[model samples]
Every structure is written in C-alpha cells, then in structure tokens.
Target: MYQKSLVELAADLQKGAYSSEELTRACLQRIHTHDERLNSFVTVTETQALTAAQAADAAIKAGTAGPLTGIPFAHKDIFCTNGVKTSCGSRMLDNFIAPYDATVTQKLLAAGAVMVGKTNMDEFAMGSSNETSFYGPVRNPWDETTVPGGSSGGSAAAVAARLVPVSTGTDTGGSIRQPAALCGVTGLKPTYGRVSRYGMIAFASSLDQGGPFARSAEDAAVLLGAMAGFDARDSTSVDRPVDDYVAQLNQPLQGLKIGLPKEYFGAGLDTAVGDAIAVAIEEFRKLGATVTEITLPNTHLSVPAYYVVAPAECSSNLSRFDGVRFGHRAANAQDLQDLYTRSRGEGFGSEVKRRILVGTYALSAGYYDAYYLKAQQVRHLIRDDFLQAFAQVDVIMGPTAPSVAFKLGEKADDPVSMYLSDIYTISVNLAGLPAISIPAGFSNGLPIGLQVIGNYFAEARLLNIGHRYQQVSDWHTRSPQGFE
Candidate 1:
C-alpha cells in the first residue's frame, strides 16, 4: 500500500479492492510510526482526513468517483486549508489558521482527494536547505544525515519516505524540483500562471507556482491534472484550458528534439551528478530523443538576477504581515511601530529576514534602477535564451542541482553556497517556463535529477517526455532502504 502510486491507489479504490478509510488510516499510521525522525509534517488532520475518506468511499459506492477520488495526499504548509494551520513553515504564522481553502486545496477536495496534513517547509519558502524551517530541517529519506532540498523538502521527503503518494509543493526558483532531486522523487514546477496562486502564501509572487511531489512521472501527471486550472480570483492565473496530463503520458518520444545547454555542464556541476544525467539522457536517446548541444549564454547571470527580482517581489508580498493584522503579534509592544518591528523580528527566521532585507534594499530608492531594473533585463535575456533553444528543440534537459543533497549544516553559514544550490532551477522561474525534476540516478548514495524544461504551458509534453523516459528507466521506482 505504501509503495503504490496515486494512480495505482486510485485504481484500487475504483476497483473496490480497499476502502478509502483503509488507505487513509494506513497513511496516518505510517506518519505516526515514523514521522518523528523525519519531521516532515507540521500538522496532521487525522479527523478531517478520516471524514473525507469516508465521504470519498461513499462517492465511489454511489458511482460518482473521479480519477482522483479517495487518493490521499498532503498539502505544503503554504497552501491555506480552511480550519487548519497554514504555517508556511514560519514562526510568524505558527498560530495562524486559515479561514478559507486555497484554490489548489479547493480543487483537490472537489476531485475527492483526501488531505493527510500540512508538511514542513523552509520559512516562508526562502531557504535552499530545509534547515531554515521553523519546525526543523527535513532529513533526506535516502540518507538521514543529509538535508532534503528546500523549501519543499518536507513534501519531497514525505513522498520519498512513502508517507504520502504525492504531496503539494510550491516552486520559487527550485523549491519543488531541488528537494525532489535531493530526495529522489519526481517533482514538477508548472509554467507560471498555469496554476492559480490564490490562498498560497506569497513567496516572491512572480516566481512562486504550486505543483506536486510524487514518486513517479505517472503519479505526477495524475496529481498535476487535478491541481492545475484557472481561477479568476488570482490575477496571475491564466485563463487557459487545463490539459488532461494523464491521457498523454504514453505519448511516444520519437523524433523529439532535446536541447542540452553546454553552460549547465560547466565548472559548478558535480562530476558524478553530471555523469548520472549523461546516462539518463542516453536512456532518453534510446527512447528516440535527439539530443543537441546548445548554449544558454545568459545562464551565468541567472543567480544574480534571481536574487534581485525574487527578493524585490518577496519584499512587496510580505509587507502584509505587519503586526496590526493577522499572524503572530508581540505582547510587549510600546507602540504600533514597536509591535511591527518586534513581531516581524521575533516571528521570522534568519533566512526570511535576510531575503526581506535584501529585497528591501533592492526595492529602495535610487537602488531600484541600478539593481532591480538591471536584473529584469537579465531576466529577459534568460527567457530569450530559452526561447531560442526551444526554436530548435522541444525541451531542454540538464542536472537539476549542481550536486546531490549536502549534509544539514554544510552550507548553512555560507549563504552564497546555499543560494547557488538553486543555480540550475532559478533560471526556469525567471523565464516562467514549466520544468520538472525526475530521478535520473544516484550519486554517492544520494539521488541525482535530470531536469526537463519545456516552453510556457507545455506541462503535458514535459510530463509525457518524463513518463516515456521513466518507462525505460527505474530510477523513480527506487525507494530509500528503510522506507520501502
């Protein structure tokens, strides 16, 4: 049951092989039995999950079950779930209970999926490592000593650990894919605006997009279908028809043109990780994909550009958290200003503060044109590079992260190193393209990911190509030793 994918679980439910209650209970039992060491979940809604499961069972018996009916999963803490804590993995919102469900939450619930709980994440989705999380860093299920990539590390860890079949995640830069790469799970970051962001705690609104963490590309397609679609409530949400991602999973990859950016294989990428990606691409070749060497000349500037744009946006988005409103408030305030200062200072963790300060500085007077404006220009160049590459190829592929997961505190003190962890992923956010990180192979006992990037709104092709590659390779099937 734990090893089953969401699609497989859905089939079981449809076949009446097991009740939703049984599957939900099994997942809750697994969380209770093992979550202490992983620290993956911030809150587990056992009662609500059971109630939802019972309803799903009834729906199935009444012959009204959808593809996602009775599929149990967890939400990233950032998504607001009515009557449940949506902490965003920050002390500032630790006591916050959302009054309404996020669009993603509402959509998933409408499809009859059962929510297990909300998982831990980097504070306000700011850090590269899960270490910055208020709860605690999520340990990589593959190797407990190493960190799971953040800020979606907890979701990745939970899926990798078989605590959940698939879990919701948000990608700002590489939050979803980085952690998925490190934890050896299949993670997708949809094209910006492909999914509605309403009720999802803003973390650099322009860069953040919600997707899912799953054990396989097939499972990813199933979850992505249910999570995507337009909601008029979010101004950024595109009014495009959602693709039936699952129906296209078996599409052959013959004659598919794949671009391999020469810049990505340069100095920073780990040799073993690079070698693993090479082997994976070779498998894609066997699946009839034609790989070509290309240059994303502006790749070098992505990190610096992302630092400016993301922080500037984050600074603006987070301004609403002042003590006068909802969320944590300081008790010993001498005045309104004191309340705002102390509440924010005491509420947010170090990484969030660092980003907020950096963001504020970038958005400050005089520096705006020099920093933020120049970064936007660099962002345009990055997008142009992807556009040019796409002119010759259907999708671009590369190592998702420079290396595999590092030890928990290895780069904690060195913020630059931590930021560089997302070097490969941030560019996609800048370009607002859809990208996915699927398990390619392992390096030094840790997982390596081969990222598949597609043009805007090309999620179906991305998932299709990934699913085809997965058919020939079993990397996504490999589970952490103890968890299996």
Candidate 2:
C-alpha cells in the first residue's frame, strides 16, 4: 500500500479494492511508526485526514471521485493550512494557526485528496540543506546521517520514505529539485506564475513557486493537474490555461532535442553524480532523442544573483513577523523597538536572520543600485540564456545537484559550500521556467537526480519526457532500505 503510486492508489479506491479510510489509516500508521527517525512531518492531522478520507469514500460511492480522491499527501509547512500550525520551520510561526487555507490546500481538498500533515522545511525556505529548520533537520531516509536537500527537504523525504505518495513543495532557488535529487524522489518546479502563490508564506515572491514531490513523474503529473490553474486572488498567478499534466505523460520522446549545457557538466559537479547523469542521458538517447552541447553562458552568475534577489525579497516579506499582529512575541519588551527587535531576533533561526540582514543591506538606499539592482539585471541575462537555448532544443538536461546527499553537518558551517548544492538548479528559478528532478542513479547508497528544464509553461512537456525516461528506469521505484 505504501509503495503504490498516486495513480495506482486512485485506481484501487475506484475499484473498491480498499476503502479510502483504510488507505488513509495505513498512511497515518506508517507516519507514526517511521517518521520519528526521519523527522519529516511537522504536524500530523490524523483526525482531519480520517474525516477527509470518509468524505472521499462517499464521493467515490457517489461516482464523482476524481483522480486524486482519497490520495494521502503532505504539504510543506510553508503553505498556510486553516486551523493548523503553518510554521515555515521557524520559531516565529510556531504558534501560528492559519485562519484560511492556502490556494494549493483548497484545490487539493476540493479534489478530495486527504492531507495527513505538514512536512518540515528550512527556516522560511532560506537554506540549501534542511539543517536550518527550527524543527530540526530532516534526515535523508536513504542514509539517515546525511542531510536531505533543503527548503523542500521534508516534502521530498516524506515521499521517499513512502510516508505519503506525494507532497506539496515550493521552489525558490532549487528548494524542490535539490531535495528531490538527494532523497531520490520525483520533484517538479512549474513555470513561475503557473501555480498560485496566494496564502503560501512568502520567501522570495518572484522566485518562490509551489510544486509537487512524488515517487514517479506519473504521480507528480496527477498532483500538478489538480494544484495548478489561474487564481485571480494571487496577483502573480498567470491567467494562462492550465495544461492537463497527466494526459501528456505517455507522450513519446522520439526525435526530442535535448540540450546539455557545457557549463553544468564542467566544474563543481561531483564525478559519481555526473556519471549517473551521463548514463541517464544515454538512456534518453537510446529512446531516439538527440543530445547537443548548448551553452547558458551566464550560468556562473546565477548563484550571486539569486543570493541578492532572493534575500532582498525575503527580508521584505518576513518583516511582517515582527510580533505585532501574530506569531511569536518576546515575553518582555522595554518598548516597541525592543519588542520588534527582540521578537524577530528570537523568532528567526540564524539562516533566516542572515538572509534578512543581507537582504536589508542590499535594499538599503546607499547599496540598492549596487546590489539589488545589479542582481536583477543579471537575472535578465540568465532568463535570456534559457530562451536562447530553447530556440535550438526541446529541453535542457543536467545533474540536479553537484553531488549526492552529504553528512548532515558537512556543510552547515560553510554557507557558501551549502549554497553550491543548488548551483545547478537556481538558474531555472531565475529564468521562471519549468524544471523537474527525477532519480537517475545512486552513489555510495545515496541517490542522484537528473534535472530536465523546459521553456515557460512547459510543465506538461517536461513531465512527459520524465515519464518516458521513468518507463525504462527503476530508480524512481527504489525505496530507502528500512522504510521499504
């Protein structure tokens, strides 16, 4: 039951092989039994999940159930869930219960998917590794001692452990793909504005986009179909028609033109991980696709540009948690100034504070043009690079991360080293294009991911290509030892 993909689970529910309630209970039981070791979930809504499962069963009986009906999934803690703690792995929101559902929550619920809980994540989506999470780091299920890649690490880890078949995650500079690679799950970051941002806690407004993590690309497509669409409530939500992601999963990849950015394969990529990606690309070639060496010349500037832009936006968005309206408040305050300073100081974890401070400095009057403005200008160059590449190729491919999951504390003290973990993925976000990371192979018993990038609003195409690759590969079906 735990190993079944979302599509299989849905088929089971439709055929009455098992009641939705039974399936939901099994998922909840698994979480209770195995999650302590993984520390993947921040909250478990057993009662709510059971109730939703009952409703889904009722819907199935009434012949109105959808594809996601009764499927148990988790939301990354960054999304606001009505009446549930919406902590973004930060002490600031530890006591905050959202008064409303995030757009993603509402859509999934309407589709009849059962929510088991909220998964843990990096503090306000700030770090590349899960160590910055205030709830504690999420250990990779593959090798317990290693770090699950961040921000979306908990979501990826949950799916990898089969705690849930699929989970919601937000990508801001590789949050979704990085962890998906490390945890050996399928993760997707849809084109910017493809999914609504309404009610999702803001990290970097422009860079943050919610996506999904699942065992396979097929499962991911099903969830993405339900999670995406125009939302007038979110100013950034594009009014473009949502693609039927699942409907395109079986599309053939023959004659597909794949671009391999020379820069990505050069320095920084780990040898084993790069080799795994090389094999994955050859498999694609065997499927009748042609691979070409393409160049995204400005790739080198992505990290520096992302650091400045993301932090700048985070500083502005996180300013609301200053203890005035809600969230954690300092118990004793000398005055308003003391209250604001002490509350934020105590509320945010170190990484969050570091980003906020850096963002504040970048946006400060004297440095605005020197830092933030320069980063934005560089962002355009990154976006243009992708546009230029797409003119000659159907998709671009690369190693999702520089290497496989490292020991939990390996790069915690070295922020720069940790940032490079996302060096291959940040460019996608900077370009506002769709991208996915699927398990390609493993190194030293840990997983590596192959990243596939596509042009704007090309999620369906990306998922299709991923689904085809998965048909000939079993990496996505592999599970962590104890968990299986």
Candidate 3:
C-alpha cells in the first residue's frame, strides 16, 4: 500500500479502498520508522496532517474531493507555509514562522493534498549537494554514504524512501533534477514563470521555479497541474492558461523527434551514466520515436555562465537578510556594519557565504561588465542554441547529471567540482525551458537519470515521453532496498 504511486493512491481513496486518514497515518508511520537516519524532514505536522486527511476523507465521501484529495506530500523548507516554520534551511530563518502560505502551498491545500512535513534543503537553496543544509546533509537512500543531490535533496530523499508519494521542490540551477536523479525519482523543473514564486524564499529569483517530485511522470503531471497557474502576487507569473497535464500523459510518441546533444556526451561524463542514457535513447527508438544527434556548441560555457548569472542575482536578492527587516539579527552589535556582518556570518553556511562573496564580486561596479553582463550575453547564445535545436527535434535528451550519486563529502571541499554536477541542468534554467529527470537505469547499485528537455511550456510533451518510457520499463518504480 505504501509503495503505490500517488495516482493509484488517489484512485484508491476515491473508491473507498482506504480513507485519507489511514493513508496519512501510514505515511506518518513510515516517516517515523525511517526518517531518523534519513533526516529528510525538518518538521512533521502530524496533527495538522491528520486533520487535513480527515477533511479530505469527508470530502471524498461527500463526492466533493479533487484529484489530489487525501494524498500526502511534503514541501521543501523554502516554501512559506502559514503557521509553520519556513526555515529555507538556514539558521537565519530558523525561528521565523511565515505569516502566510506560499502560492504553491495554498494551491496544494486547495487540491486537498495533505502536508505531512517540511523537508530540509541547501541553505538559501545555494548548494549542489545537501551538505550545505543547516539541518545536516540528506543521505541518498540508495547508499547511506552518498549525498542526495541538492538543494531539493531532502524532498527527493523523502519521496525515494516512501515517506511521501510526492513533494514540492524549487530548482535554481539543477537543485530539483540533480537530486531526483541521485535519489531515483522523477522531478520536473517547469518553464520559468509557469509556476508562481509568490511567498517562496528567493534564491537567484530569475532561476528559481517550483515544481514536483514524484515516483512517476504521470503523478508529476498531476502535481504540476495543481501547482501551476497565474498568481497576481508574482509579477513574473505567466498569465497563460494551464493545460490538462494528466489528460496528455497517454499521448503517443510515434512521431516524436528526440535530439541527443553531442556536447553532453563528451568528456567529463561518467561512462555508466552515458551508457544508461544511450540505452534510454535506444528504448525511445524502440517506442517508434526518431532519434537524431545535435550540437549545442555553447554548452561548455553553461557552468561558467550559470555561476556568474545565478550568483549575481543571488547576491542582489539575498541582500534582504542584512539584519534589517526579517530573519536573524546579531546580538549586542556595536555598529550597523558590525550587525550586518555578524548576523550574516552567524546565519549562513559556508557554501552560502562563498556564493554571496562570488556574487557580490561579480555584481560589483568595476566587474559587472566582465562577469555579469558577459554571462547574460552567453546565456542568450545558449538559449539560441536550444531554439535552433528544437526547430529540428521535438525534445532533447541527455544524462541529467554527469554521474550517479557520489559520496557525501566527495565534492564538498571543491566548489568548482560541485558546480559541474549541474552542468547539464543549468543550461535548461538559463534557457527558461521545461526539463525533467526520470530514473533511467542504475549503475553500481546507484540510480542514473535520463533528462528530457522541451521547448517553452512543453511540459505535457515531456510528461508524455516519460510516461511512455515508464510504461515499458520499471526503472522509475524500483526503489532502494531495505528502506521500506
């Protein structure tokens, strides 16, 4: 019962196979049994969850429930949940309870989904691995010694461990996809502006978009449908009509054209991951989809360009944490500068601080043109490359990460190495394209993910592709042993 996909669970609830309270209790029980070592959750709202579940069960009995009614899901700590401590995985917001709900959270509740807990994340959503989280790193369920990719690591870990069937994750430069790949789940980073950013903690505001993590592409589609839409509170939110994502999940892939980027298969990519993605492409061909080799020449510059753009925006957005309006404040400061320095120094983790410094330097007066402005120009080139490729292919395919989950501390000491883990994913964000990571295969007992990149607002097509693959393979349904 615990292993059921969210879609199956929702159906079961609708048929009275089980009440929402029973399902919620089972999930809470699973979290209690497994979360101690996983450290996936920062807070578990047992009472609130049960209350919500009971209401969902009553609604279903009354024939008034929505698709997600009685379904349990977790939220990344960065999303502001009313009356809950929306820490954003930083000590600065440790004691800060939000005054209101984030647009995403509010929408999920409206859909009758039960909020089980808040998952841990990288401080200010700033790191590639969960190691930078103030709550401590989220260990990959595949192997306890490996780090789940971040800043959505905890969300991925929770889903992977069956603590929840689905969860919300915010991606800024690969946070959601990378972790989902490592943890063996499906994650979608929707086209920028497709989802509202209102009440979500800022982290490279231009790049951060909240999406869903789930066991299957169809489930992700349902969650995405619920979470997406225009919100007047977020100026960047797109006013486009939301599509019926689940309705398109069964679309045939017979005439689909998938482009395999040459740059993504070159040096630095792990052989195991490469082989797995190659096999997935072959599987796509078997599904009657056409595969073609394409080139995105500027792909090599993605990391450097992302480093400049993400950090510069981050530095500007993060300036609000200067011991002024909200978050942590320093005690007994002699002067204003001391207060600012000490508060930040005490609140942020090492990676967050490093990014702040790098961002500050890049955005500084003398260096803005050399770094920030130049990266913006390079970003346009990357976007142009994708636009050109999409004219020839229906969707793009590649390995989500260069490799499988690495040991927890493997890249912690080297920030540059950590940044490269996001090489494939950062480009998607830069282009503001929709991309998803689905469990493709495993190597040495660790999961590898196959990424599907689509044109702007092409989430439904990506989901169709993923759903077709999932129908033929059980990779996405396979979970790490001993966790359940």
User: Candidate 1 lDDT (Cα, whole model)?
Assistant: 0.93
Q: How many backbone clashes does candidate 2 have?
A: 0
lDDT of 1 by residue, 1-484 (tens): 9998888899999999999999999999999988888999999999999999999999999999998899889899999999999999999999999999999999999999999999999999998889999898888988899999999988999999999999999999999999999999999999999889999999888889999899988899989998999899999999999998989999989999999999999998999999999999898888888999999999999999999998899888888888777999999899989998999998999988988999999989999999999999999999999999999999999999999999989999998889999999999999999999999999888999999999999999999988888888898998888864
lDDT winner: 2
Where does the lowest 10-residue lDDT sum fall in candidate 2? 413-422
Candidate 1: misplaced stretches above 4 Å?
none
Q: Would you give me the overall lDDT of model 2?
A: 0.94
Per-residue error (Å), model 2, residue 54: 0.5
Q: Name every residue pair that clashes in candidate 3.
A: none
- Model 2, 1-484: lDDT tens per residue? 9989999999999999999999999999999999999999999999999999999999999999999999999999999999999999999999999999999999999999999999999999988888999999999999999999998999999999999999999999999999999999999999999999999999999999999999999999999999999999999999999888888888888899999999999988899998999999999999999999999999999999999999999999999998999999999799999999999999999989989999999999899999999999999999999999999999999999999999989999998888888899998999899999999999999999999999999999999999999999999999998975
Q: Give each prediction's root-mean-square deviation over alpha carbons.
A: 0.8, 0.7, 0.8
Per-residue lDDT over 138-157 for candidate 3, one digit per residue giving the tens place of the 0 to 100 score: 88999999989999999999
Give TM per candidate: 0.99, 0.99, 0.99
Ordering by lDDT: 2, 3, 1
Error of 1 at 186 (Å): 0.4
